[model samples]
Target: MGDLAFEPPRGGPTLWEIGIPDRSAAEFYIPDPDPNYINKLYVNHPDRFRQYGLWARYTDLYPDGDLVYTVGVSDYKTDWFFAQVTRKKDDDKYEGTTWQIKFNLETVNQTGTYKLRIALATAYVAELQVRVNNQNSNPPLFTTGLIGHDNTITRHGIHGIYRLYSIDVNGALLMEGENTIFLTQPMSSSALQGLMYDYIRLEAPPPNNSTKKI
Candidate 1:
């Protein structure tokens, strides 16, 4: 739920451990589902993305900002539609192996500025970009988790860390309504893939209680 991180290369890929097997003052107390929704979910299969190719739609593909975002993914192969958006995985063996595009309330209500915290699920080769509406925002808030060029990565190393990333609206910022978030990675491959997003937080307006129809 917050910025997720790994120790570094060699820790064998760090993943956000399940929240509550034990009780803690700072931890959220969640009981196991009677049937475990995640276990029975349809998207956790190895061929889920394969049916839709590597890349899949993240959210409702709504318009929240002022840009048109064109999207794709590259797992060092073709663009893929990474799933698992949550730390909770299907088999639970390597939940960290998958990446997700789901967003939280904080991301949905993004206002002034927003930031994404990413944690490496596994040590996989990877790159990431954020798009809005349909266009890759100019200057692109996030890039290959790298800077400059020359196979030179800024957040390169292992366990990548990135911040800010203007995103779709830019100076205009994101609005309420429907929006989209995309995350991608290979199926348990050894590359830069990680938990695409640890968490999304923003400085937004007060909660909307309006019943008015848009």
Candidate 2:
């Protein structure tokens, strides 16, 4: 929802995320959704030079209702967008909010294994529904257990690395060219869970056949 990074590789693949401010307190918080208090959303397109093949959209919900936010490559904006999330009384999983993030690779030059990376601040058994293109009914490529959390170690917030792979749910390799990766966080432990996305890298594998020269 910020500067969606699409810079060309300097040496290897580049990284993208919300750059923290110089000072400590600059860290922002996504509070529990409430009617009286509204949080503004930041949505914008990448710079024109590299905007041809990237896009993103999401929807957040509060106890009261639903709010939608969308930003595309050609249509960029910096207006007031609000978001809210509140914990449920009876249920462990927060309900009603759905996030759909996609990358359109038809025009992208690079090809090969593009690893999808996802980072989260805090969660309890986060279910990541992944799909290629817009095939919603297609079974998720993979689902996460209690990852980045209490399963292996006792941690409260922010896992250093992401949990994702280019392979499908059936353990098959994802095809190169014109593919879109989708991530959906339907339910989570906290209220209004934050999905801090990292960069998706495209790596070209070695050629299948090779000839040795004398």
CA deviation > 4 Å runs, candidate 1 = 1-111, 146-171, 184-214
The pairs that clash in candidate 2 are 33-85, 41-81, 141-169
Cα lDDT tens digits for candidate 2, 36-78: 3322341232212121111111223234433322223321122
lDDT value, residue 114 of candidate 2: 39
Give a tens-digit lDDT track for model 1, residues 87-134. Answer: 223343222222223222323323323333333222224445555433
For model 2, the local distance difference test gives: 0.33
Provide backbone clash counts, one per model: 20, 3
Best by lDDT: 2
Return model 2's CA RMSD, one decimal: 12.1
* CA lDDT scores, all candidates in order: 0.29, 0.33
Deviation in Å, model 2, residue 211 alpha carbon = 20
- In model 1, state the lDDT of residue 138: 59
**C-alpha RMSD by candidate, in order:** 15.3, 12.1
